[model samples]
Target: MRVAIIHDELMRRGGAEQVVLTMLKAFPDADIYTIAYNSEGTYPEYKEYKEKINTSSFQIFSKSIKLMQKFYFPWGIIAMKAVKVTDYDIVIISNTHCAKYVNIDSKALVFIYTYTPFRLAWNPSSYSQYNNAKGVFKWIFDKVISCLKYIDFKAALRGDYFLAMTEETAQRIKDAYKVDDIKIIQPDVKTRNFYVSKQPGDYYLVVSRLEHYKKVDLAIEAFNELGLKLIVVGNGTKAAELKAMAKNNIEFKSGLSSKELADLYANCKAFVFPQHEDYGITPLEANASGRPVIAYGKGGVLETMIPYDVHESKCTAVFFNDQTAESLINAVKTAEHLIFDPAFIRKHAELFDENVFIKQFKSFVEEKYEEHSSSVIKSH
Candidate 1:
């Protein structure tokens, strides 16, 4: 079969990009289509698939990440519309943004693996930038989002099948697109690549993009008050502002290799995850390294982390109820008193291994394709 994979953009090595890379491994022969491609800005592994990767007319504007960020919405929609996938027998869209709008053959089986319905368009309140805007700018932003949401909803109807990264995201898809039939397929981690250290270091760890929504500031505040060591790994638009807010106890690092990150996970006392994510992978990565997680008790983490309960012996994390420093600090104190088993933590993480994701994803595609083929034959 002539298979194609369409992703929103290739500008950064975030969780969505990681899912795209895994999809590439599952369908090695499939040609990749994207709105943008930035070799240095994204994962180096993508270079291996350079020949099979194709971009849209927006590639010229996307060459600069800053320019792409400025005009990503309407331009993304236009660029995706221009991508012709009509020749392909199957088109799998790995979408968080606008890739669902790609033109495909009427006979092609199109599967959309979505991270979340376009958050900026459907849920503008979640974004700090959007909330910070005032008067005419906020009014214009809302008007544009309204238009984009309509377009996004129409694009969503084109998918022959839909897969969500988590149950939380599935509900979001249903609410945003009004699409009821959705499958939940959680993203996985390389559990085997991590190992438990016999001796953990004297610091907590955080591995996430320093974004406004991530709530890294809460961690900084909690750690500052506790006067404990914290090593934050990852950078983003909020890097400078976050760095300035952090005290001397909080150290920031970025651009570490996978191995380096795994090592940090292995040696840290515990992982700090303050954000409410669609489906978080960092907490699982920490658990894979046989470390406990101190996380906000909401969103996708609730599905992944086994919260500390007196009745549950397999608990791998302590949960904070709110996004405030006091709530997190109290959770940290509770975690300090509890004893976690590394073997059990690692075992829990193994349930969401990359191999499992590949197997399930491939099987689902093959089964659906066979059904589609049978239907096409009957139609003819």
Candidate 2:
């Protein structure tokens, strides 16, 4: 059976890319497709798959038309649709953002890893850029978001099935697009490397992409008030600006491997997650490492972490009601009083172990194909 797995891009070995790789392992013979492949050397897991993956026709958009691509996402649709994939029996789209836009032939099952549809119109960067753009350019970006929101549904209708990574996203998909039928396929977090015996309980840590929505500034501001040391691990467009705002107790760090992140996860006094992340893996990492996570009680964290009475008996991690700095500070202060059970934290995180994700996802793909087979037989 010829299978084609589609991904938004392999820009980094982040949670989304990990899902695609796990899919490749499940269907070793399947051909993988992507719009870009920037994570070429960063992740060694795909060394053998280097030859099996299909590159997109929109290679230029990977670089030249990049920033503009967010607002003008149809350019990506036009770019990806050019690929000839009519021959495959199955086409699975693993997406956080853009893989859903790819066009494929009928008959193949289009299973999507449905992360919440980003609010394109209110997206901070595009909104900021649109507000500042001169004359016609300003109108163009604003129009594109509204236009793309419409196109998104037209494109979304392509999905034969939907796979939500978390319950929060499942609800969001239902609310955002009115699509309620969904199968939950959580991402994998390799826990073999993270063992918890001792922790570096001095500094609170945050590992994230440092995007505007991540609300890293909120983390920094809260920690600043608490006078607690904060070590942030990530680099993004907002990194420099965030670094500039860093106080004496706060430090901005980046470019750490998963192992290093796990170490921080295991050692940190507490993990600070201020973002309304789509589906953050770091919080899972913190849980797997037996570290308590301080997260906003919204978005992905709502599904991943638990609200606890105290630390020693925390269900998973704790969440603050609001995403603001003050709310985070209050949560952190309360967290300090709890007596955490390292074993319980690790055990809770095992629920989201990468192996489980792979097993469930593989079953979903294979099951959908089985359903597809029956429909074909009945039609004939």
Candidate 3:
């Protein structure tokens, strides 16, 4: 089948982009369609696939999409609808927000891999920067946000099937779109890239986008109070704010090669994850490196991480119930007390390896395609 992979944007190299990459491996000949793309802005490996990518006119603003997304959504829907993908037999939309609205052939099966129903639409309060506007400014902001949400909801209805990244995200999809049929498929990590380390160094590691919701500031605060060595990697809008708040013990690093990041993961005392993600892969990556994690006790980490307990020798992580510096500090103490086996931790992470994901995702898609084709034959 001629397949086309559609996505909202390609501004950064993150979990969603990782999903796109895995999909490309599954359907090697599939053409990629998206609102915007910057070859250098994401993983360098993606540059090799440049010939197969097609971007909308929005590519011109790819660099600043983070700032212009509010405006991008309303116009992006119109732009995507006009850009045809009718020639393809399968059109898979990898979306968080607006790419679900892309117009395709009525007979084509459109599968959507939803990261989470547009977070700004479903849970605006999570974003402190958006909520900080007061009086008339806040009023206008809420008004526009609400209108965009309405459009996003309508866009969601266009998908022939919805695939959620986790059970947590499936609930979000059900709550937001009122859609009952949803499939959960967690993303995967390259297990071969990481391995068990016999000796660990004196530091904690966190590799994440410095976004407000990620709560990197909390990790910085916790590490500061403990006076521990914490290495914070990745960059985003909140990078400057987080840097200013961090103590001398907390070091920020950005743009590390995969091998370099694997080395850091292998040597770190423990991985630190402060965000409540839709489905986090970093913790799994750390586990693959045989390092335990200190994470916020909620969200997708619950699915991937086995919480550390004094009695549980096989636990791979310690959880903090609250999103606070004190909570994380306590969790770190708990991690320090536990006995984690490097080989056992690596074995746990093997369940979510890239090979497993590629197999399951391909089977799901093929099954759906066969069902759709049989039904169409009967309709005649």
Q: Of the candidates shown, which would achieve the greatest lDDT relative to the real structure? A: 1
TM-scores, one per candidate: 0.97, 0.90, 0.96
**Whole-model lDDT for model 1 versus the true structure?**
0.89
lDDT of every predicted structure (CA atoms): 0.89, 0.74, 0.86
Winner of 2 and 3 under lDDT? 3
* Tens-digit lDDT string for candidate 3 (29-63): 99988888887788777787899888877666777
**Which is the winner by TM-score between candidate 2 and candidate 3?**
3
lDDT of 2 by residue, 248-291 (tens): 99977767776776777778888888877778888888888888
Cα deviation of 283 in candidate 1 (Å)? 0.7
Could you tell me the TM-score of candidate 3?
Answer: 0.96
In model 2, how large is the Cα lDDT of residue 27?
Answer: 79
Candidate 1 per-residue lDDT, tens place, 1-380, comes to 98899999998778888888888778889999999899977988999999999999889876576688687777767887988987888899998787888888797889999988888888788889899999999999989999988888898888989999878889998898888999888898878779999999989999998888889999999999999899999888889999998999999999888789889999999999999998898999999999999999988898899999883357889999988999999999888887889999999999999888888898899899999899888999
**Rank ordering of all candidates by TM-score, starting from the highest:** 1, 3, 2
- Rate residue 251 of model 2 by lDDT: 79
Could you report the Cα RMSD, in angstroms, for every candidate shown? 1.4, 2.7, 1.5
Superposed by TM-score, candidate 2 places the C-alpha of residue 46 at a distance from the truth, in angstroms, of: 2.8
Ranking by lDDT: 1, 3, 2
